[model samples]
Target: MRHRFGRRVCITVISVGALLSSPAVPAVAEGAVPASAANGSGPGYSDDATLRGKIISRLQHMTVQEKVGQLFVVEVYGQDASTVSPTMAARNRALYGVDTPAQVIDKYKPGGVIYFDSRRGPDNVQDPRQIATLSNGLQTAALSQRQPIPLLISTDQEGGAVVFRLVAPATAMPGNMALGAGRSVTDAHRSAEVIGTELAAVGINQNYAPVADVNVNPANPVIGVRSVGEDPELVSNMVAAQVNGYHDGGVATVAKHFPGHGDTATDSHFGLPEVTHTREQLEAIDLPPFRAAIAQGVDTIMTAHVVLRSVDPSGAPATMSQPILTGLLREEMGYDGLIVTDALDMQGATSTYPPNVAPVEAFKAGADQLVLAPQMDVAYTAVLDAVGSGEISMRRLDESVYRILRLKMTRGLFKDPFVNVELAAKVVGASDHLRDEQLITDHTTTLVKNDSDVLPLTRDPQRVLVTGWGVTTTTTLGNAIGRRGQTVTVLETGTTPSQTRINQVVADAAHSDLVVVSTMNAASVNPITGLPTASAAAQQALVKALLATGKPVVVSGMRNPYDISYFTEAPTYLATYGYTAASMESLTRVLFGEVNPVGKLPVTIPHANGSGALYPFGHGLRYDG
Candidate 1:
């Protein structure tokens, strides 16, 4: 069960460095003390002032090598004595005696930590409260040695498939595409508040979210379900709502993939992508959401690994292009927030330049934070050298540090680095969590097609056969059926389909009174093109199989709603913008007369082969009373 905001809030740091024997540390203003000491003077510290002072104090006390350490954000997970001990051992041996959480915190402190599921342990999952307690304990341990400076506890909580579930009391909200369906800024605001409140309860101060990429291209491999909508204005409004939601709840929000990744057909996580739109087209469509987010006082912006040839003719991706990051984002957009680089270890970044060199170039290009490095020492050293050689200005470093510290201050990190674990346990997963989960589930399930009144499935349909490559026992859809009926049967089709196998699955469905077909475009890897077109084989076989079922066939989209055209013959169709357990339950309720389908298409579903662009952006069927 999910926790309420107040309950979750009850639950839920680092380091120093080498000094002396380095070339000229930047001179600090005389009598300037650490921000903690300067508190209670004047208007108190705004996020900017507090952050500036902290960065300056660190710069004054840090050696060149230590300064480099501050630039590399390495990946670390888990607290199993055996696993962490060995990982720390390797860091100590390779990165100059830095080992243990204490040493990592005290010596080579990185700007932030990137968390994933593999890092969590079984003990942390006993209950919502226990999860909160364990998470708080883990964070507390990470920063035990340092004074309260805002340490960014970050995660990719974009809803749907990208949620981190191990932590206590943190409930996953609906994906952006679902929010976009309602086209209601109110829904967006509510979502942000819910997500932000849960994050605050668990001690997470930063969320890498509100994916600003416009989903203009239906075939976009990576951003289909993640984006809010294709229309720039709609995306902008929704982004602002999400940012405000996080801020109101006391967690910083990051607007991502600047300059847009909406029209591209490839996934940046696997390889480099190029967007060939002219500057005007990009400014008109791709940049509005970012601008809106900035206006709403978003704390951070994450750069995409997309290469926009028209925007930056320098032949470098936006993550490493000064013309895009410095000139366009900073100067033109008037954004003063911390600019973070997307994971540098991803092929999009690593494929272009050596890992060590990329961090320095990214900094030079005006990135405030370098995320996900393969070798922390190498990347850190490269940045330090670049700064020392005067290739990157100290002022630029100060600018980045100022924004980061400001965010920390705004989050009240300096005042209270730890939450009362026992209290957090009491409130972390309560009624509010469940309520928000239901709201998102209700608001995101869309009714794309309902012919012959097949929906609100008659009580106890004689035989129900669920056939799709995407449906499985673990999915919420499967769970919903498993709880009430024994007659339902589920079929799993891997990533792609086999004509022979699909035939057998469909043949079984023909005997059933109701047949539901599902498909998903989970991950695509085309470096040269960013499109995520449906597989021809899968599309053909699924459509053929569903048509052959003869029963009332309901084609359900468990991913983005775009691929529904593949099963054109189905009399009834529905789109659950995401595949979360809650969404699946909500979808089943609509199908089985449990709840009304209130969701509308947030984005257009283009025809196969890009023929007919049916249901253009913001098209959804409203069920009138």
Candidate 2:
């Protein structure tokens, strides 16, 4: 109940006690919780006197402007500042409203800079070398300032579902849901460790990863495949494994979307998601995994933008709610780890307030760092003005900067913040990493539904018709599928296919001895659902068309596991979690009886025609070898 004084705090209290008799907590009902609920005695809360002394020492050398700068961690191109022309900087200023990544550091004096996939320098040049050089320059700029603090260059390197943003050049691992399906804590650790090496190799010290959200809602358009599974305990255990792996690989970890991003049907990226679950329900379900994450000693906790009505009756986003951030996470949960807000650029956090004031509000709400505020200049000005006018206390500002600097010190940034540009190029995307990535995909390639016992697919490669959406027609999986002296008519379906177009492909299925189709159907609400909805529909239509031909269709949901709900009549079905080349190779090996699939379904595969699951969470089939 510390920091619980405002009307906001009262509303949160109401939410916590709103339904005491509610069935939200069976464990609480069964007397599973400890007597102490709101005490700040947890492992993540740093009462380390020495660390506090170091933070105090660091604070003594900083000015008010410097202290304010330390509270912001905004976006930047992870490239050298020298390479950027003044004209390009102006263009970026005009386009993105920032002078330059380095200039922003010089002016705003931010604590960190998050990297993204953008054209570095004036030209559209992209490479790992640019990333390393840019990081070195950003750190150098930080150190050369009045207060020589190293910049914490961070990225969203959550290795799951897809090879996205910064980690594209590195080895592609099977994502979180796939890792859960494989059901190996060892694999989860190894996968994160491998990703960490790649991240560190490129000079990224902090990784916003190991999504702790349990995918309890399949219609949850954003967190669906990104989450490990729907089960809380299972997600908790996997989150711990990932934290260990990140540490093992020497990367600072941030276990994110705290409290939980699961169970919400809307995507926070597009707009605010209204979470109506009672506090009891959240404690029993969503809160446990985060509690587990804290026990694992996570470095940072990122807040979700979603509004939990139970926590705030006025429906404030968690990032801007003192009740959620300080009351729940900091006091009740006993987590003193750095509280970083999710990008203030998202609609979920911005819909209620003018986007420009996010930085000030986020800090007031208890967040240590303002992350990725798109309106950086306006937000930075807001913070400066607030601190100057006494709207925000100077002491409070120092506390956040202390945490930020302490994290930098913990990352060994003060001593050796720079990476060897050459070493970065050599170590990043290492050849050996591919072997590890392949192993992950091999284990994660789940055979979700094989009702016809047609897996360990017959090796007769005589004119096999291979059709898929999302993946290229001919890749490692396609090549391997036809390796047994057979020709494959690779038919690639467009993401937006006309029904007539799907009909044509179905008509062409007559010439082939066997038909195999792969569809990517995992759903996430990016503030709006129907991500590739048309493609899912087309794939379903293609399958139904093939079914009409009596061609004994073999189907694989290369991305989403829920695809089995759409193509229920398939004699054979598979869910590979990801559509990567590595996953495709694993599917090929499984098809030829070279590898036995031990993968389980991470989330429940809902029945296509209804609300129930065709195969529940943790369901997977085996071949009688």
Candidate 3:
């Protein structure tokens, strides 16, 4: 079961270069310290004067290499601390001159480590217990160094499309757009708190979450569903709520992609995205959520790789724009928190600069922590060289290192960096957490269209065909319907199903009494062209083929709700916003009248003809309404 706040606070007392076996101190909390903690005064973690004094003393003794290492938070290719697949071992050896995560920490001594689990490639997480074990091992290695400092362990557990690293066995949320649809700050906080509690129990201390971007562009590929909604006010409210939730859940919060990544059509992963909003428009729309985040005292703010033409005019992404990061955020907004770069390895930030130069440039641009440098060893050395040549002043470098160490101390990492590995298995994916997640999911299953009152499955169609994009998710939904006493036939139409497969599904649907078709961003916009992909075309074709069969068709949108604008003729439509099992189950309940659909549209669904909104924001249909 999920423990209540202040119920499981276990503090570990730590001093530099030594593990004191003294009794535990009553730390502030698992994931956070007070806002004053940043200035060297917070209870539980450390006494204020002592905290600052100790960090200074430690800094005095550290070598230049060690100080430079503190600026980076790199990714290692390994599942376990000491063991890795042969291919992964080779990659690790090539990158860090080591074959395991623990060894990498010992050799290069990065201030932090970020976890990835097949979302981008390579798996550092397997299950809750394994993750806790790995975190403990990494901490042990970091502490074993000459100048011991506990590593900041972080992952992108944003709870929807971005939760791939820690999805299963960790409560899966319906994501930010879903929360926006619900429009309930209480639900948003509860959801993030549950996610945060589960992560902290498993030894993950930092979360890159509560995406503060107010997604204004419908064609935005990266931040579409991940964004809370297009409305800046609503997104701001949700962002603050989620920030508090994560902190209360025992993890530090990062409000991300500042000054904003919402108004672009480009995906920074593959190319540079430019946001051209004027400073006035930006303040009105894109910047409010981040402002709210700062008001909520968010632990960190991440820089986007997108360029804001009005802000810098240097044609540089915000990751390397000192004007945006230091001037706008630090000086203008009065945000004194850590500023981290979006992964430097991404094409968006490093396309112009080589691997070695990007990290140094990001530091020069006022980022406190450089995340995911492509080549850690080379980047580390480059930063060291730049500092040696006074290219990056020692004062600037020390400012970042102090923030890094301060964050570690405030988050209770120095006090107790290890987690109870055995308890992690029990705490994560616990029934209580799942129940809270289900409650949030229940609020996010939006009924966008129910023409002719076709929903509630009141006719009790005995034969139902459940077919969609993901095989596992499709089968899961079919099983849910089957549990409701329907004879359901499950078919997996690939994301871009072949014509033969579409034909096969159409034939199968003809024999069924009701056809439920789920689309996974069927009309997904291409990042570069701002047009739907061929896969989207194929998925649309499959839906059209099914509709022609004359069965009672229920089109379910499992990812983006915008797909509904394309198939305007569908009699019934629902937007789950995700394909997580919890969402599918909630969707099944809404279909069979077990629950009522209360979610509104977070973003406007543009008409296929490009005239106007087919379904405006805040539009939803309840069975009774």
Highest TM-score against the true fold, candidate: 3
The 10-residue segment with the lowest total lDDT in model 2? 25-34
- Which residues of candidate 1, in runs, are more than 4 Å off? 1-25, 29-67, 80-99, 119-150, 163-169, 471-475, 478-486, 522-536, 622-625
For candidate 3, write residues 43-88 as lDDT tens digits: 2233445576666666766665677778888888877888867978
TM-score of each: 0.85, 0.88, 0.91
How well is each residue in 374-428 modelled by candidate 2, as lDDT tens digits? Answer: 6665676567666545567655776677667767776778889988888877777
Clashes of 2: 9
Order the numbered candidates by TM-score, best leading.
3, 2, 1
Writing each residue's lDDT as its tens digit, candidate 1 over 474-583 gives 24465576565637777776557777778777778767777766666522323355334346456556666667656677777777786566556667778887766677
Error of 3 at 198 (Å): 1.2
Instruction: Give lDDT per model, in order.
Output: 0.67, 0.73, 0.83
TM-score attained by model 3: 0.91
**Model 3 — which ten-residue stretch has the worst lDDT?**
11-20
lDDT of 1 at 612: 73
Model 1 lowest lDDT segment of ten: 5-14
